[model samples]
Structures are given as structure tokens and as C-alpha cells.
Target chain A: MIQVGVNGYGTIGKRVADAVAAQPDMVLRGVAKRSPNHEAESAVKREYDLYAADPDRTDEFEAVGLPPAGTLSDLLADVDVVVDCCPAGVGAQNRDIYDAHDVRVVFQGGEDATVADASFTARTAFETARDADAVRVVSCNSTGLARLLAPVAESFGVETARVTLIRRGGDPAQTDRGPINDIVPDPVGLPSHHGPDVNTVLPGVDVDTAALKAPVTAMHTHSVNVTLETTPTADEVRRLLADESRLFLIPEGAGIDGAGALKEYAMDLGRPRGDLWENCLWGESVHVSGRDLYLFQNVHQEADVVPENVDAIRAMATDTAAAESMATTDQALGVGLESRLDTDTELPDSITADD
Target chain B: MIQVGVNGYGTIGKRVADAVAAQPDMVLRGVAKRSPNHEAESAVKREYDLYAADPDRTDEFEAVGLPPAGTLSDLLADVDVVVDCCPAGVGAQNRDIYDAHDVRVVFQGGEDATVADASFTARTAFETARDADAVRVVSCNSTGLARLLAPVAESFGVETARVTLIRRGGDPAQTDRGPINDIVPDPVGLPSHHGPDVNTVLPGVDVDTAALKAPVTAMHTHSVNVTLETTPTADEVRRLLADESRLFLIPEGAGIDGAGALKEYAMDLGRPRGDLWENCLWGESVHVSGRDLYLFQNVHQEADVVPENVDAIRAMATDTAAAESMATTDQALGVGLESRLDTDTELPDSITADD
Candidate 1:
């Protein structure tokens, strides 16, 4: 079994640790946290042995009625793959830590692609990451865009893709961010970093992204417009995405109103953390007027990458192909099942060809 | 002042009557309703004279503490123009009523193009509807689509347009409709009739629409993709949409999440019925890659068509020029002010042409 240690116990790290634990072929060795705070306490409560990232802060855990399993150095020695879920920039600082231990490492989106051997979106970048020493899973936006675009690229051949990401102000637990009641060009740039990040997975796909952070904290919704090399019917586009297990086409008749309702629906479905691990695509929204395909989809920022981390863990520690690893991760996580987010399968009249 | 009467005191009809009353150059003579429901009582409460759509059901008004001012035929006699906001197909049935009275008529989008002398989207079809005996305003979807497309077609020239309408199941007060948890093709076909309806206003414009009815009740969002004859930058696309009074480019700082928060924002702004009369375009969403332009925009179902109906009334009842009518209607209804929806005006680095 592959021993996976998560080197950050925040939103993504905690989930990644849980996901690694859930994988049949993997074992959650421990998770590292900088402080003995509530999250660290929760990690202890969940029975995950905690390792202090800062060796000097080992006493902080003991002071809080909890004891550290060991320093992060101990984690590096025991774990086969260390998933670095450090806050932005910190992962880069900790790069030498993993290298010194000679432990294969997996970094979350926070780290730049340069921090790893390859940027990974399991569906597209898995093969490239196999046996790689350091792999960085692309950000939520990249993962979402890559998952949806890869299928289209494989089937119809995409000429270009334009996606607008309406991002949430902060994570559900992140009370610190936002213009509160405003949207701003994130990172203050055009074709924000997300588009180029997507290219890290799909390599040469022509994609440009316009991004704005909304005031809400639910998830990021991508309004996608794709120009395909071939002019396909709407039905053809629907079947292509529907066949991909990660792209959950939200069918008509589902009581989901918007992201707000989608969250509630996930909670009602008893999803852990009300997570939408797969891309939530609107089936009825999928349209092909001619050579263009238009649709709106959402990516759960914290949870979508959990399974990718699981697959990346397997890729680093085992010889399983990306597809096989993805299938196993998906099955273990109860994903890729007939989606409850969109239950109806009937096609709209505008998409149906006149037979 | 031109005399105007509205038929069917439902969602679109009620708003049209209020819009007519708000116009300085137009007078609301009365509104007709078949049943003396709460809406008919509201007409009385708002000091709007209520007329019996069915002359034989005059007592129904008296039973609900609503006194009928007169019959619909009496309304047609007194009013110079009738805005028929009757349900779909019912406006077509009422075609004979307007013809018998020889009164110029305005029909809402529910009626087909054949129901009137010209199909109307004030921004695009006002000239064609000018002084016509009858003008049919396109559907909420058509009106929204036409308003956005006309500007693009005028400035950049559109080659083809594809729109996917994520529609609300029914109006907030419309409780009888829906699968409640289901999204269904309204007509069970591809290239929904909405695209054709848009063509009625902007004739010869190559456009096709895909439609789905979600369980939402607030507003309709259009996922739009258009191939323009000229290639433009994201900045050019933003500036183009920003300049249009009917298109409110929602910038990043506004903090509006989806239609829910958008409605709340409108209500907080003290708009009547918490309505957003203009299309809420995401400023950060406007993207231009090569010859294609993509964006996500919302058309407030009840409020968007109000000002358009006012313009149509002036187009038929008086010799007011289309531009004059639009300016007047936009001014009086507070339709086209600097949208409080998107507050920021800075350009993103991607779209900003200069370093």
C-alpha cells in the first residue's frame, strides 16, 4: 500500500488526507499542520495522526491536549508520497524538504507548475506524471476546464475555447477574502492564469479564460464557449460529455436553481462536505448551433481535486494507468454514478435532429 | 399623451401596465383580466382601473371587492393603443378584438410573429414597428438575445449566433408549473423557437437557440456565443457592451452571485418589484478570441420587456421616432441608468492593450 502524507491541514489538505485514506491501494500516514488550531484538533478528532510542519511548534500540539505523531521530517521518512497542500508559496519553500527525503511528492494547485515535473489533471496529465518525482495537480479551474475540454478535443477537435470563470469570494471556511459586494479581475489580468494553467494539462489546446470573483462562496461556474474543428449537432456534443464519468450533465427537471440550489442538492444527496467532485454541467444548457458549442458548468473548488490527489498518489506509488486509477478512485468515492445533480436524461427539442 | 390599455393582468401584463403609467407621454387607461384574482385586486389597490376581459364576468370583479371600470371592448374604444400581455396563443385569439376596434396594438413575446404586423424588440425592431397597426414584442429570451446581438451586429457585424437559454420554470407567483425537480425541453425540439422569434425582430441574422426550463423562478440567463465578422479584443467587447444602456456589464466588485443575490441587490437599490430592466452582463465575462465573442448575461423576466412595451406603444400610437421613444422610455422607467450592478471600471491586464 502507498503511504500518503498530507503536508497541510486546511481546506484542501484535510480533504486530500481523507481521500487518500479512502483509496484501497493507499494508506493515510499522517497530515502536517503549522499550528494546533481547530483544524489540527479536527484532524486529531478524525483519528489522523498529526505531524507539526514547524519542528519547533511540536510543543503547541501537546499544549492543546493533543500530541504530534512526529515532526514533518518523520512524515517524509515514513510516507511513500507526500501531498503538499501548503498555503500559496509555502509549498515552494518546502520543495527541498521532500527532495531531501527522496519521497515522491504531490503538490496542490497552490504551487506553480515549475515546482513539479508536470502539472496534472489526471484525465490528461496522468500519463505524463506517472513515475514523476514531483506532480502538481492543476487548480480547480484548470481541472474543471481540462476535464470538459479533453473529451471535446478528443472527439470533435477544438479550434478554440473561451471560458468565463465566476469565482466565489472565498472558500466556505475562508472568512478573510473578497471585495465583499463586488467582482474584480482576479490577479488584475486578462486571460487570467487559469487558461495557461489548463494548457499545462492539455498542452497545445487554444483556450482563453476571463475570470471574475463573485461575492458568494459556493463554487466557481465556468461559462464556456468552444469552437470545434468539426460542426457537430447538439446531440453529438451531449453524448460525448455524458459518456465521460467526470462531466455530470445536469438534466432538465432537476430542481436545481443555480449554484445555491446545487449546493443544497448535494447536501441532500448526503455528499461529504456537500462536495461536487465531478464537473456539474447543465445538460439543457449544452447547445451546438453550428460549429460552436456553448454550456455552463461549475467546479467545487476544494473538493474536485481530492480524487485527483488520490489518483496522483497511485500514479506516484504504483504502476496503475491513469484511467484505471481514476476509475478506482471514482468508484471508492461514489462518483461517476448516475448523477443526482441532474437526474433527467431527455433531450431538448432544439438539440434533437429531425429524423 | 397616448392612451394605453393592457390585457391579461399577469406577470408581463402587470409590469407593462405600470410601465405605461410611468411614461410621461403615455396614459394607462385600464388593464383587463378574466378573473378577479389578487392581481385584479392589486390593480384596484394601485389605482389602476380594472376592466373585465370577458364582459360576461363583470360580477367576478365585484365579488372580489374589485369593481370593473368597464369591459375590454370599452377599453379598446378609449385607448389609442392596447398592450396585449395575454398568455401564449390567447393574444392571437384576441387579434380580432384589436382589428374590430381598429386600435393600434402591442403584443408581448408570447404571441407568434404572425400575430402582429411586425415582430418587435425595441432596440432592433422599433423602426419596423413604427406606425404599424400591430407590433409583437419578442419573448423574454428573444428580447434579451436581440438586445445583446443588435449592438454586436451593428458595431462588429455578427456572422452567426448561438444562444442557450437557461430559463426559469415560472414567475415567482406562478406556482402551478414545473416538474419541480425536473428540467425539460419546453417544446421538446432543437433550435428552439426562441431563435426564430429573435429573427422576426432582427431578420436575416443567422442565429439558433437551445432552451431548457430549470426550477428557477427569478430570471433567465443566456449563455451566448457569437462569431463576429471582425476580430476584437476583450477590452473592445467590454467597452462595446458597456456603452449600451440596455446592457449592464456586471463588473467583478459588485459581489452579485447569481440571480438570487442579483434580485436582492436590485431590491436593495429600491427598484420597483426589485427589477433589473436591463440585461446584466458580466463585464469580466466579455471575451473575444479571434472572431468569436462569448458572455453570460441575465434578462430579468418581468422587468426587461416593460420599457420595450412602452417604446412599442409610442411607435404605434404616436409618430415618435424609435430613438426618441427609447430615450424617453429609458429615462422615465429608470431603465438605462449607470447600472449599480457592476460598480468597477478598471480593465484587466489581459484586456488592457497597453502595458
Candidate 2:
């Protein structure tokens, strides 16, 4: 079994631990936490050997009424791979921990290119991190735009893409978000730079993206306008999109509504906790009139990237073969998380098996 | 010369007055205001002989250092058409006003059906209002959806159109609009009554719409998921859309961004005011992949519907020749109101000329 240890027991980290533990090929060695906060205490109560990062906490382990788990050093001792679910901008510090432990690390989006020494986007940036010890899953927006644009770019030869991304100002933990009742312009700058940022992952694509923060937290819905060098029929295009496994095309007869409906659908499907692995795509909303086509897609930031991280982790741990990495990643991250969050149930067998 | 009088000088009304006055064939007879507030007095300085709706201020017409433009009744005396820019459910009162003066009246969407005898929409709703002296402009969402859906329904037999309307919480004026930062489901229940309401205009087509109010006042964007009975090529559908004068297809080659770019293009084109007569459609964004197609469109509520109101007015006025009336209506409305709000420069003769 591939021993996996998760450093950081926050929302994403905890979910990662549960996901890793659910896999047949994987065994969760332990989970590390900061100090004994309410959340950390809860993790400890749930039988996760929560390790405090502070060395001082190791000396006080007995004095504090907590479990007999050791420090970060102890958690890193026997792990093949580590999923660093630390806060944004803290990946640099975590990188050192991974380097010191000589373990492969899956870093979140908050870290810079220097932190991972590898970029892990499916399309543009995937090959860049091919040999690097660390891999980074992009932000939710980049992943979403990249997925949609990749197929179009390859098949149709994209001329220019003008997209208006209606992003939710609040993350799951953020309480205060928005000018509440107003739709402000993305940023008052040309190209908004999000498109260029996406190009970092999707090379050779000329994309100009503008982002507007709306009063939402669940997902970001993108109003994408793409100009293709070659025209493709809407039907042909939908077929191409449906080919991607991560993309769940909202079929014609399906009565799904917005991102909320999509999230609820995944949750009902007994998906991995948080159900972030699936891309909620609407098929009928994909209208291609002439060389131009329109598509509406909802990208779940926290959840979508989680599975990508799982893939990155597996790739880092085993040559287990790149062709099999994607399938393994989905199996590792996609299934049980949805069920856990929904029914509060433990790991289910269907999800743990690699397809 | 066509004499146009505005009854309520609010956000839309003031723009209408300036629009009418700028036209060579139409003359602004005067405008009706409540009382001589600083804003109203300033309107008088711009030569809109202000009148009062308050009965008590009937005689104060001469006392306010203004012309004897009379009360709301007096304002209607020689006016060929009166445009009611009043609040919701109140524009119905203009029916009596129109009948008394034996002139057609243009009503905004704010007026409920009970308030007005008939509704005026670009998508054949005028057929229902064909007999009335009053014609009502449909709500912004209704108007935008109807215009986009009409051709689609006619060409490919609409199976079902599921639309998620992200509406502005309130107009720029209203203080309290919504659940603030929360994404609240539109409480009115099932397949929003809007689709049914549109069928009133187009009898055979079946459509469904859901509305959610965001906290912004600029423009309302729709996430439209439509499944047609018969599938057509995306290009074919785009060609049909391109044929419509009010529908602008944002082609792919341009470096333009979102609807904002479309708005700027309209402004540069010397439209009557910076109002858009057609839907600022993203042409390249219309994607037809397989049987599924996607499209993104921006509806400028204040701008797009303004000219439609003018069209409905002319259509309602000409009782003898329906075809001629509609033909004139299309041309008049197509003059492109994009120039009106551009810069403080007079519009080009071709755009400002009255039909």
C-alpha cells in the first residue's frame, strides 16, 4: 500500500485524508495539525493521529489533554507522499518540510511556481511538471477555462477568447464577501491578466479573460465567448466536450439548474466528500452559431482541484504509469468525498477501487 | 412633425426626452415632472418645458419661471404620443390619459398588465396589443429572452428552454433589494412564470425561465440552457441571428472583451444615445457541439428596450397598414441608439434622422 500522510487538517486537508484513506492501494499513515484548536480537537477525537507542527508541542504532548500523536517530524517519518493542505501563501514553508522529509508533495494553488518546481494543469502546464518532484493544481478558474478551451483550441484553432467570469467573492470559510448588491467590472485593466495566467497552463492560446465578483461562494459560472479559426457545429462541439471524463454534460432532459443544482446532484451521487471532482457542464447551453459558440460551465474551486491534487500525488509517488494516473486520481479523490459530506458516512467501497 | 411628450422624468424618461428632441422628425413638445425640484428645474433649463402631475401644482406652471406647459392633462393636449416612464403598476393610469387626448401612449415595463390594456414586445406580442391605443414594453428579461428565442423556436421547434436569469437586485435607485450576499433561489416556485408569460406573445412556443437577483445594477446576464426538438448546425443558427438587426454578433477576431466592449462599440457607432437597439450578442461564443449548443448574451435593460418602445409606439400609431407600421418600426428602432450616450457630441445625420 502507498502510505499517504496529510499535513494540515483544515477543510481541504481533512477531506484529502479521508480520500487517501478510502483507497485500496493507499493507507493514510497519519494526519498532522497545528495546535489543538476546536477543529484539531475534533480531528483528534475522530481518531486521526493529529501531529502538531510546533516542536514545543511535542514536549507538552503529555501535559495537554490530547492524543499521543507526535510532531510534524513524526508524521513525516514513514510517509511516501504528503498532501499539503495548508493556508494560501504558506506552501513555501511547507515545501521545505517536504524537501526535508524527501517526500513528494501536492501543493495547492496559492503557492508560486518556485514552490512546486512543477506546474500540474491538465493541458498547457501538465508536461511542465512531468519530472518535477512537486506538482501544483491551478486555481479553480484556470482549471475550468483550461478544460473548455483545450478541446476547442486543439480542434478548431482558437483565434481569440473573450470570457466574462462571474466569480464568487467568498470562499467556503470567508464570511464577508462582495459589494453584496452590485456587479462590479472584473478589474479595470485590459485582459484582466487571468487569460494570460491561464496561458501559463494552456500555452499558445490567446485568451482575454475578465472576472467579476458576484455574491456567490459555491462555484464560478463563466460566460465564455470564443472565436475559433475554424468553425465547428454546436453538436460536434458538444460531442467533443462529452468525451472528457471530468466534464459532466448537463444533458437536455436533465432538469439541473445552476451550480447549486450541480453540487447537489454530485452530493446525491454519493461522490467523494465535497464532490469537487466533477465539472458541471450544461450541454444545451452550448450554442455554436457559425464560427462562434457559447457555453455555460460551473467550476467548483475547492472540490475540482482536490481530485487533481490526488492525481498529482499519485504521479509523484509511483511511476505506476502516467496513462493510469488520471483514472487512479479520479478513483482516489472523486467518489467517497461526496458521500462523506452528504451522509456523514465513512468511506464506501465503490470509490476506493481504481477503475 | 411627430410630437412626443414624456410623463415621468426619471432615469429612462430623461434619456427618452433627449432622444426625441435630437431627432429631426420628432419634436419634444414638453415633459411632465412632479414639482420644481433642483433636478426638475435643471431639466427645464435644457428646454423640456416641465409640467406637474400633482393636481395642486396645476396652476404653478407659470410661477416656476417656466413656460405654461400645463399639468399632466395640459401636457397631453397637443402631444401626438405620451410615453409613461412611471413606477411599476402605475403606468396603467395613462390609458385614460391616452383615450382623453385620442393619442397612442408608450408604457414602460414597470406597469403591470392590470395597469395597461396591452403589452408591446418585439417578438410578435404586438399582435395582442394590435387593437389598443396603449402598447407596453415587456420587462428587460422578457424582452431579451423573447428576441433571442423567437428565431430559435421558429427554426428548430423548441423542446424546452431552461434559463437562469441573474437579475439586478434593484434598479440603481432602490435601497433594499435582497438577501444581500446570499444566493437565494427565486421564491416564486417552479420553471419561473416568465416562460409562460413570453408564450403570451408567441402563442405556440414553450419556454421556461428561472430568475435570481444578484446585487448589481449594470446589466442582467442569462445562463440559457435550451434543447430544441430538431437539431441544426450552430452556423445555421448564427446566420439566422445575424439576419436580425437588433442582434449584434460579437465576432471572434476582435480583441474586444465582454459586453462592455460591445457597449463601447455601440457608443462609438454614433447611436442616438449610447443605447443599444439590438442584443449585444457574443457571436463566437455561440457553440454548437453535437446536439448541444451554448451562447452568451448581454442585455442592457435601460438601453436595448428603449428603442423597442419607440418601435412599438410607431407600430401602435399606424392602424391602417400593419406591415408598413412594423417596417417603419424596425427601421426607426434600428437607427442604433448607441451614439446617444457616447460623448457630448451631436449624433450623425443618418443615425439621428427621423424616418
Instruction: Please provide, for model 2 over A118-205, each residue's C-alpha lDDT reduced to its tens digit, 9 standing for 90 to 100.
Output: 7666544545555777777776677778878888898888988888888876543344346466777768676786786677678788
Q: Where does candidate 2 stray beyond 4 Å?
A: A56-65, A123-127, A177-179, A272-274, A332-355, B1-355
Q: How close is every model to the real structure, measured as TM-score? A: 0.50, 0.47
Ten-residue region with minimum lDDT total, candidate 2 chain B:
B346-355
Model 2's TM-score against the true structure = 0.47
Poorest 10 consecutive residues by lDDT, candidate 1 chain B: B346-355
Candidates, DockQ: 0.01, 0.01
Candidate 2, B121-190: lDDT as tens digits: 7556756556676777777777788888888887877777777877666433333345466655674697
> Best TM-score goes to which candidate?
1
In CAPRI terms, where does candidate 1 land? Answer: incorrect
